[model samples]
Target: MTALRTGVTALAVLLAIVLQAALLPHVGWRGVVPNLCLLVVVAGALTRGAHFGVVLGFCAGLALDLAPPADHLAGRWALALMAVGLVAGLVRRDERPTIPVVLVTAAVASFVGASVFGLLGVVTGDPGVAVTDVLLAVVAGVAGDLIVAPLVLLPLMVLLTRFEPQRRLA
Candidate 1:
């Protein structure tokens, strides 16, 4: 990737995380905060490729894990988001995803990402994380993601396209 691409991606990821941890908490549905970091990785992977997605996912997930007020295990989200990025990257690299596809992708990514994190929490002896809670989170998280994905992912994808001219889809 070009320097421009790298800078833009980093900035975009930072902005998404900031907004996700700050603004979305109050504005989102009760009990569910939007996962903008996951959306960023998904957008990067879908528009860029699998490797890009995986790397971004790990970085963003680590950032989230280390962010303040995080109570869960450090690697839980990292592993989950890595899985999300891997799956997102597996989509045909040449495909220019449409709005509906992006929405569906967000939903799937959010569900998978949250599920993996919750499962890991369970395995790690977190008494508060139950299957019922996981299911609820998946439901609420997917709903919130679908609503926010278009608003956030599209612009981020546009930035990625512009920053990495050669990677822009037809």
Candidate 2:
């Protein structure tokens, strides 16, 4: 079951990355693409725990950093998404969260992820990020993530929920 869950998780992350790379860029809102990969990590953390979220975040971010069309330094996103996972996981509860809670969490995660990525770029002396309107990008990215979160999170939550340990009826 663990192996199966791991395999499914890997496939899901890979699919998210593929979609993020291919479909999302073309349909971006206000020059910011929705981050399906970050959503996946959030779902994992919400369903599983912080540890899983952190690991998945790192792996997914690394893939995004290395994916084709990537023109920025590697590890920036890895660190950023890892931070997202950590924050989301810290906010997770044993029971399911309400819609508002989930949305707020997604917004926070989106903000943190984008901010960290942009900050890392600035720290690393990336010329593109130095001049980009980071505040606008962050706002747009958060809005985009919020807009797409329900669509992405619902299915992902269903898939990830299967990985939870079954409750024993006493």
- Candidate lDDT values, in order: 0.83, 0.87
lDDT of 1 by residue, 34-127 (tens): 8888998898888877888888888888888988778788988888988899888887545567778777877888888999998898899898
Candidate 1 collision pairs: none
Pairs clashing within candidate 2: none
As a TM-score, model 1 comes out at 0.92
- Candidate 2 structure lDDT: 0.87
Query: Model 1 lDDT vs. the true structure?
Result: 0.83
- Scanning candidate 1 in windows of ten residues, the lowest lDDT window is 161-170
Error of 2 at 55 (Å): 0.7
Poorly placed runs, candidate 2 (over 4 Å) = 92-94, 168-170
Cα lDDT tens digits, model 2, 1-170, are 88888888888889988998789888997557999999998888777878988998999899889988887888989999999999999884756788888889989999999999988888888877653577778889899999999999878888888877787745
